[model samples]
Structures are given as structure tokens and as C-alpha cells.
Target: MKSLATLRAVSAPALAFVAGFMHAWAIASPLGGQPVWWLQLMALTLLVILLDRCRSATAAAWLGSLFATCSIGGSVWWLYISLHVYGGLSSAMAGLSVLGLSGFLAVYYALAGAVFCRLRPRGPAFRSCLFAAVWLAADLLRATLLTGFPWGVGGYAHIDGPFSALAPWVGVYGIGAAAAFVSALLAAVLVRPAQICGAWQPLLVVVLVVVALGRSHEAQDLERAPAVSVTLLQANIAQEQKFESATGVRDALEWYATQLMAASTALVVAPETAIPLLPDQLPAGYLEKLRSHFATGQRAALIGIPMGRIVEGYTNSVVGLGPGADEYRYDKHHLVPFGEFVPPLFRWFTRMIKIPLGDFESGAVGQSSFQWSGNRFAPNICYEDLFGEELAARFRDKAYAPTVLVNVSNIAWFGNTVAIDQHLQISRMRAREFERPMLRATNTGATAVIDRFGRVTDLLPRHTRGALVAQVQGSKLITAYAWWLSRLGLWPFWVLVAAVLTVAGRASRE
Candidate 1:
């Protein structure tokens, strides 16, 4: 009996780690395929079951933290490749950096677990709802605080699942919250057979949510603009040699210049930093020649190039060329931490790595979209699409809302990993949320056209040098997500979480 009890104690922490690992696979399976939504729900359900059995709030918190550390660490383990193999950080330092980030993010979940244990409600239904609310609050905080690295939220798992229908109405967080509630309910059923009589209420809520978000939220036809012929360039430059002037830089400049001059599409796009140097830094007449060619006729090109100098501030910017396209510039507003800008007290850390052009000036939030061929093209840099709320800001003005979403990225820093598949899914989520077709131009992979329905209509194979020439249709009508997120921001979700938690607290006291 003593040995059995000892075995139980050891198994709990191991089980938590396993649950978190499973959660990571559910987000973007490391096995290299689409996310399985059921797997994610089951993983969270297991965590909830474990939490319910914890004797103390502190114990639950520790278990939750361990689970989250494993989940987040497993999800973004590719960061180590960028840090050690590419950024020149030592293997030990790279491993610690990834662990540090994962642990820091796990704090949110730790708090949630503690709160759930402390405010344990009597009824299974109310208790499950409370757990869901607390989990969602943690997710919201993670997505908002510290520049928001919400890479592998639970909702991403459901992009191709049943709950995906909820995306246009409540967005990713809402879907995740619903999944949490269901996970807790499943846990309640297994862990609390005595509370089986109270299951109807939670089950009813789930039914209502499904009926409301799924049935009422059917896809309606949006105003369709004329199709635009776009040529998306994917140069597939190696991250190590991307900035080298003699090899990667020279080849990119020559190849892109040749392609730009030869393309007949109405809109032509190159991946981010396709020209890794400034205009003046080019070998003379390089910028002017392309501009002069695109200056006339209806054909236009949106090329990614850096602007400004070291003395002032350089920007990761895109310049539009062609008749009505010139004079149009869109600077990247959302910058990546460590890669684009070092955080406070992190200057020492950054100096140890070798990321070039690590610092950049940020652009305004409401920059105008590039207008060409009667379609407004909203541009987002690498990982910018991860924040759907920021993109919703443009929907504040229906007249000027982006007809097409354009993403230019160079995620070669992480090499050939699930990051490509994950990023493609992120872009697809944006396409689903805003009901706007997404056009992606990447340096290495997932260069494709996603329809407003979030389906990949055209795709170029990863790690290949090619151009994706396709006809893309732009949408005019806004999704419910765009409409509300633009008007009220994340306040609705904040209010939902607050109200649920308040009710749960009052019930616990009763």
C-alpha cells in the first residue's frame, strides 16, 4: 500500500507533462499533419481531471504550470533552431531561452489552476463553467501582455474542426473558451459521478452555443470585387546567406528584378525583404529602374525593401510601384521581440546573438491599404496575422476596409519546420475571421492564396523557388468578428470572462 501511494504521487507530475505534450501536438502536430481537435479537447480534459483531484490549490497550480510549460515548450521548440543554429547562441543558452519563455507564459495557467481550486463550485456544471472562464482569462492575458506571443492557442486546433464555425462570431479566444468548458465537462463526468444529475445545465449551454454559433452563423455571400491576377514570388533564400551582399542579396536582386520586369499580372508581390538592402545601398539605378518600369500602365508591384538608415531608424517596409501604386508605403507596425526589437534589460542578451537589422521603427496602426485594380490590399508582415484584433482595426471604416489581405514573410530563420504549416494556418484563421481572401508571399514556404472561407486555393511547395500565379477574389462584406472586434475591441470577451467569474465566485460562496 505504501508503494502504491508513492507510485501515485510520481505519476501525477508525469501525467501532467504528458497532457501538455499532447496539447502541443493538438495545436500543430509535430508529427507533421493537421491538428486533431478531439486530441486537444481530450488533453485539456485530462488536465482538468488531474486538477480536480489535487488536494490543495498550490499543488494544482504547480501541476498546471508543469503542464503549460510542456505544452508551450513543445509547441515552439523550433525557436531553439533559430537561436542556436542561426543566431549563433550556444546550445545550452538556446535551450534555456526556450524554457525561460515557456515557463514565463505558463504563469498565467498557474494562476488559473489556483483560482479554480480555491473557488471550487458545488455543482459540476457551475464548476466546469468556472474552470472554462478562468482558463480563457489566462489565454486572454497571455495574448495581450508582453507584446502577446499567442502562437499556439487551443482554438487553432479547431480551424478545420466543428468549432471553426464559431470563428466569425466569437473569434479564437471564444472557441478556445468553449473548448475548455467542454473539456471540463468531460472531466466532470469522469471524475464526479455523484454530480451526474447536474450535467444537463452545462450540456444545454454547449448545445445552445453550437446552435447559435453554428446554425445562425452560416456563411453568407459577400460583395465580390473583380478578380485580380497576382504573381506571388517565393525566392526560398537561405537564412544564413540572406543578407550576404555577394551571394544571396545579389542573386535575389537580380532574380526578383528580372521576374518583376517580365510578369504580366495586374499585381506582383515579392516576399518580405526580397531586397535586403536600402535603395542607396543598391548598385546604382536598381530602385529607379524598377520604379520607372512599374510607373506606367495598370500593372503594379508591391516589393519588400528596407527604408531609412542606421543614424536615424530603419523600417521593414514595402514600397508600391506602378501608376497609382507609387508613393504608397506600408511599414510593419507589429514587430517581433528579440528579432526586431530587444526588450528592457535584454540588450545584453541580444548582443550575444547575431540577428541583423534587429532594431526597426514601427509604423502607424491605421496605415492605408494599397489601392490597385479596384481592390484595397491590406499588408501584414511576418506573424502580424497572428493578432486578428489588430487587423480588425481596419474594419472600423467599411469603405476602406481591406478587400484583400496580403502577407509577406521570410520565416527562413526557423528553417524547414512546422512553423511553415503553423503560419499558413494562422493566415487561414485571419482569412476566416475577416472574410477576406489572404495572399501570402514567403521566402521559403506556404506561399499561397487562401479564399475568404479560409481554404487554400493555390499553394507553392515549401523550400522551392517559384512564383504562385493565381486569380484571387477580394471580399467587400465584413464578418461578424470584424464588425464587433473593430467596434468594441476585446471588451466583449473581457466582459464575458468577468461576468462568468463573478457568478462562479458568488456560487462558490453560496
Candidate 2:
């Protein structure tokens, strides 16, 4: 019996690590980058069971940290390519950097697990609810604090999962909270079969209700505005040479210019930094020629370029040509830490690397959407779609809410990795949350058009240089998520989690 007990103790942490890896797969399967929602629930259920079995908060915290380290570290392992291969960090340093970031993020889950173990209630229902609240609190904190990189949040998996309908009503964090609650309830029933009588009914009802609501959230529910024909340019520029004056920069300029000038659609879009040089640095007539073509024709273009001078600070911006005549500009708001902007004391880190244009000023939150062809187009630079609340802010004034969402990205830094697929799923989730179609124009991959229901209607093959032309229909109706989150931000979730924790703590005393 002592030997058996020792074996169990030895195996528990191993199980936690495996569960975390599987959870990462659920976020975006390593095989194809598609989300496996059932896998996520199963992995999370295992996590809850592991936490429940812990005798002390310290053990639970350690287990949670291990789980998160495996999950987040596995999910973003591609960062190694960018850091070592591109940024010129040594292989060891790059790997250590990735692990360090993952470990830092895992601290939040460790705290959550400790809290769950400390305040666990006697009743299975109460315990499950308590776990859900704490899990959400941790997830929210991860997404909110220290510039917030919520990459592997469980909610992204539900884009095509049973809880998809809940997106428009509760947003990603809320869906993650619901998933946590359900996972914990299942774990509770499994751990204590005697409580199945009370737990099974709610579980069954919850599943049915979510499935029903999700089924009803069809494309038909979204009020489709007039269709806009768009030409999305994908210039397969190599990251190593993207900023090089002679090679990638010149190629990007020539290719995108040709496509933009020839595109006959109502609107044309190029990926982030399709033009590697600033306006003043461009060959004299190059910028004016494209602007002249777009300036008068009915067809306008949204071209991504580096704007501003060294004195005033540079900006990662998209300039509108054609109809708006450079009047409509959208600058990137959510700057990527380390990659886009250096944090305090990180100046040394940036100096060690060889990344150009590493720092750029941030654009204002809730900037005005681009107006053209009777449709409002909102632009979000790469990874900006991860923050739904920032996007939600644009929906505050319904009359001016974006009809079409545009994402311009150059993820070549990550190479032809799963980052492309993971980013695509993020865009799809954003589309479902707001009931608006997403137009993605990227350098090298996932240049596609996604409808309001988060269905990809068009796509360009990865590593290809081409144009994906499609008729994108916009949505006019505001989802419940867009309406409230736009007005209150993530404040309601804060209140809900606090209230749940309070109730759970009170019930534990009873």
C-alpha cells in the first residue's frame, strides 16, 4: 500500500503536464490548427480533478503552474523561431525566453488553483462554481495585467464548439468561465459519484440549452448589409529581407503596387508593412502613382505602411487611398511587447536582438472606423483581435459601429508555423462575437474572408503571393456582447466573479 501511494504521488505531476499539453492542443491542434472543443473540456476536467485531489493549496498551486507552463509554452513554442532564427538570440537564450514568458503567465493559474483549494465548499455544485469564478479571475487578470497576452484562453476553442452561441452574449472570457464551471461540475460528479443525482440534471440541462442557442445563432440571424467587393493582397515577403532595401522591401513595393493599381474591386487591402519604407523614403513618384490611381477611381485601397519620421516617432499605420484620398488612416493600438515596444529595463534585451522598427507609438483606442462604399470598416493590426473589449469599444455608437472588420498582419516573423492558423482562429472568434465579417490580409498566409458566423468563405494558400478577391457582406445588427462590453468593458465579469466568490465563501461557512 505504501508503494502504491508513492506511485500515485509520482504520477500526479506527470499527468498534470500531459493534461496541459492536451489543453494546448484544444486551443489550436498542432496537427492542423483547428480547435478541438471537446478535448479542451476533457483536459480542463482532468485539471479540476487533479486540483480537487490535492491535500494542500501549495500542491494545487504547483500542479496548476505546471499545467499552465506546459499549455502556454506548448501553444507558443513557435516564438523560438522568431527569437532565435530572426531576432538573432542564441538558441538557448530564445528557448529560455519563451519558457520564462510562459512561467510568468502560469503564476496566475497557480494563484487560482491555490484559491480554489483554500475556499472549496462541501457541496459539489458550490465547489464547481467557486472554481469557475477563480479560474475566470485568473484568466481575466492574465489578459488585463502587464500589457495582457491572453493567447491560449480556453474560450477561443469554442468558436466552433457547442458554446459558440454564447459568444455574442458573453464574449470570450465569459465563455471560458462557463467552460470552467462545466468542467469543474463534471469533475465533481466524477470524483464523488454519490453527488451525481444532483449534478447530472444541471449538466444535462446546461448542455442542451447551450447547444440549442448555438444552433439558433445562424448566419441568417445577422442583418447583412450591402456586399462590398474587395481584393486582398498577400505578398509572400521573407521576414529576414522584409526591411532590406534591395530585396524584400523592393519586391513588396513592386508586387503590392501592381496588385493595388490593377484591382478593380470597390476596396483593396495589403498586408501589414506591405510597403516597408516610409512615405518620404519611397522613390519620388511611387507613392503618388498608386494614390493617383486610387484617388479618382471608384476603387479605393487600404495600404499598410510605416508612417511618421524619427523626430515625431514612427507608426504602424494603414493609409486609405482612392475614395478617402489618404484621409482615412488607422494606426495600430495594441503594440506587441518586446516585438513592437520595449518595456522598462528591456532596452538591453532589444539591443541584444536585430529587429528593425521595434518601437512605434500606439494609436488611440476606439478610433473611428474607415468609411467607404456605405460600409464602416474597422482595422485591427495583428494580434489586436485578441482583445475583444478594445474592439467592442467601437460599437458604443451603433450608428457608426463597424460593418466589416479588417485585420492586416505580417506574421512572417513566426515563419510558416501554427501561428498563422492560431491567428486565423482568433479572427474567426472576433467575427462571431460581433456578428461582423472579418477580412484578413496577411503577408504569406491566411488571407481570407470570414462571414459573420465565423465561417471562412475564401482563403489563399500559405507561402503564396496572390490576391483573394471576394464579395464580403457586412452585418448591421449589434450582438449582446458588442453592446454591453462596448459600454461597460470587462467590468461586468469582474462583478460577477466577485459575487460568485463571495457567495461560495459564505456557503462554505454554512
Candidate closest to the true structure, highest TM-score:
2
Pairs with steric clashes in candidate 2? 294-322
**Candidate 2 whole-model C-alpha lDDT, 0 to 1:** 0.90
lDDT of each: 0.89, 0.90
lDDT of 1: 0.89
The digit string of per-residue lDDT tens for model 1 on 42-68 reads: 999999988988889999999999999
Per-residue C-alpha lDDT of model 2 across residues 315-429, encoded as one tens digit per residue: 9998887654347889999999988999999999999888888899999999998888889999989899999999998999989899999999999999998889889989999
After superposing candidate 1, which stretches have Cα over 4 Å from the reference?
194-197
The TM-score of predicted model 2 comes to: 0.98
